[model samples]
Target: MPRVPKIIPISDLRQDASGVIKRVSASREPLFITQRGRAAAVMVSMKEYEQTQHELEILRLLARGERDIEASVGFNLEAVLADADALLAEQQ
Candidate 1:
């Protein structure tokens, strides 16, 4: 079974901002902030946010690669692998 997400009303967040930050960071999970029973904003730790951005960037690159392939653009496999390794090394 899937786990339920952590959620709290805006008021609760307002009352304990630091506590919320700690929980999100510790769990590496997004915190759903609600306003008047509707979802308002999501909060995440800096680490989580950075990791998410990196993953999205990889997805974007893959999508761009597909577009290039359809356009008949060419790239060397070794060059692509080397670039990917360098990019990943920078994140470490």
Candidate 2:
């Protein structure tokens, strides 16, 4: 299971932004920011944020590939280029 992050209110963030920032930077886990009793935003170190974004992009690409496979829509690079060349020759 994924670990739950520590939640902080926006007010606390405003009052001691520097300290909160320091805490987040020093910790491995991300911090959750709440506003009006609802989840508003997330706070993570730059390295962690970049890593998470990269992982999400990879997941998205994997999902798209899986969908294409399930729908029987795939690629044959060599065959495609050969067909393209033949078409071009015919046109010429």
Candidate 3:
């Protein structure tokens, strides 16, 4: 599991937004921002943000694998049949 960074409330951010931004910008980790005691947003350095986005994309791709199988997107019947024939020939 990925590590969760420190959480900051929006009210505290209003007091010193620059400092908070600077701190989060300097640190590669993400800062969770909460609204009404619920997680509302996240602040992270540009590199970290991009990395998070890439990870999410990979997760999305993996999640779609099952759907791809259901859709029979890349099923090669001829290739499968040839391989099965070869296997049976070898067994014989």
Candidate 4:
């Protein structure tokens, strides 16, 4: 079963902006904001927003790696793994 999205009108948001923000932050769920009975924007907690940005950056890096592979440009896999191991050991 699909879960229903949390939707709210702009006026409701305006009337209880603080409460709405609290609910979104506590629930860690997105709140859909509608204007003129149409979709306008989506609100998410700061942590969620930051996490999404981080994930997107990782995806971008993976895509870049793929492109590099296609162009036959990359470091040796074993050397890279060894470097990664050394970096991890330094933190420990």
List candidate 4 segments past 4 Å from native: 78-92
- Ranked by lDDT, top first: 4, 1, 2, 3
RMSD of each: 6.9, 5.6, 8.0, 3.4
Going through the candidates in the order shown, the clash numbers are 0, 0, 0, 0
lDDT of 4 at 87: 100
- State, as a TM-score between 0 and 1, how close model 2 is to the true structure: 0.66
Question: Evaluated with lDDT, which candidate comes out highest?
Answer: 4
How much lDDT does each candidate structure score?
0.95, 0.92, 0.88, 0.98
Best by TM-score: 4
Candidate 1 residue pairs in clash (backbone atoms < 3 Å) = none
Model 4 per-residue lDDT tens digits across residues 20-64: 999999999999999999999999999999999999999999999
In terms of lDDT, the poorest run of 10 residues in model 2 is 21-30
Report the Cα lDDT for candidate 3: 0.88
Ranking by TM-score: 4, 1, 2, 3
For residues 1-92, what per-residue lDDT tens digits would candidate 3 score against the true structure? 97766999999988999999889888876788999999999888888888889999999998798788888886688999999999999999
**Compared with the true structure, what per-residue lDDT tens digits does model 1 show for residues 1-92?**
99898889999999999988999999998999999999999999999999999999999999999999999998889999999999999999
**What is the TM-score (0 to 1) of candidate 3?**
0.56
